[model samples]
Target: MATETLTYGNGTSLQASNLPLNGSSAGKPVDIAMDARRVFEVLKNGGLAIVPADIGYGLVAIDPKALERAFVTKQRQPHKRHAMIGSYALHKELHVLPEREANMVELLTRDIDLPLGVIAPLKMNHPIVQKLGSETLARSSVDGTLAMLVNGGKFQDELVRLTSEAGLPLMGSSANLTGKGTKSLVEDIEPEILAVADIVLDYGKRKFSEPRPSSTMIDFRNVEVLRFGACYDVIQDVLVRFYGITLPEDPGRGANFSGHLREAAKR
Candidate 1:
């Protein structure tokens, strides 16, 4: 299928339809209703939407079939688990958060500037976790269990609306295939990856510091640094001071501690 490239403006302003009337390479977010509709129309039909996220480029898929297609497009491993893009409206359902963890996660990732992913706890028997497969979850889990990624931004509002409209769980994953750099610029995305999308929602290239192309991922349940990219030290500081959480043994080395959170467990 020919992937349509629609020029979309960057940032969190969700007000007013600025859909370009004439032919142009770019436009602001369409009206709230229209924006929600367009995204739903594509994803509910098993199509992929490659768009700029709070982090790097990501592909949003609401079903297993669409997810498979996204994995193939990214040339990712079949068993690799994808992260859920989260919103406040859907948080209670998306995560198995204790009141404390919920409040902490909310405070930590409340910006387009703070690029962090939270791996919150999930019930092993939960429908979404079961459908995602225990094996996949185990592989990606900090503790070899089921978890979710909280990629939050103002854009999450539209995602919340889309999920409500479609009534399907969503999977918002990095656009890159396994082993590829998480690309920040539209053109930096491999054409083969872009071609698989139903449409490319261009909000312009993201402006992030080097050595970290994507968000840093940590365990909300244990506060272990899973993967360090952007805002690594700052998040570590916040977690330590506010929550009495200890820093990861290998903070920026992307070490996996088998989900152990206690500093004494480090050896």
Candidate 2:
């Protein structure tokens, strides 16, 4: 099949290509760096992009208007918060977690190599947080905490590195319509969502496709299970064994396919 090229509202065109799943091939490293750079350039300038994650595909934007456009495109609820695309370094710099909580984040994201959405209090004075400005923050944050996804995948890791270095932040939710289960492959992403993206990075099928479409989200502040998503059982086991913290059992995807315990957990 011919490689597809897409043009976005930003006037830049992106060539979409198939990436080897999990970056398994020798060519994957260079392919990932190049694709990440392309998507990063789009996001940095307020353009939207559909990018793959281990948990699922995601819609990310940096500019407030772009963020609003994505929210509208997804028909997202007003109370739903966008998650920050993050790395271990940015999490340490941005989240003000206590030692124990911080250690848990390190173990899960770094040691265990899990894909997790970590909600924690943020450092208001952090440059990236400051750069987000008030309008974006209002939509992307909870009371005083921000949800950040760590170790989502290699492409996301590279993208976060660029955002971190530039002191910008990428924020968005699953690459699907509101209340719709997450899409693992770019092609499976809905037409509305695809139409809004300035570019789409087609990484083929992702690591953690449905019936679990997103990363397990936790409010480290209270060790609450906000969303029981991809790798829930694995994370639960690790927490129980290492920290003796027993998270509430995932009610199974059939009961909670959207992965939230409540509408409030949509963060």
Off by over 4 Å in 2: 1-30, 264-267
lDDT per residue, candidate 2, 30-68, as tens digits?
Answer: 367767887887888778888888988898988888889
List the lowest-lDDT window of 10 residues for candidate 1.
256-265
- Compute each candidate's TM-score over C-alphas: 0.74, 0.88
208: Cα error in model 2, Å: 1.1
Candidate 1 wrongly placed segments (more than 4 Å): 8-33, 111-113, 123-147, 207-211, 249-267
For every model shown, the clashing-pair count is 2, 0
Top of the candidates by lDDT = 2
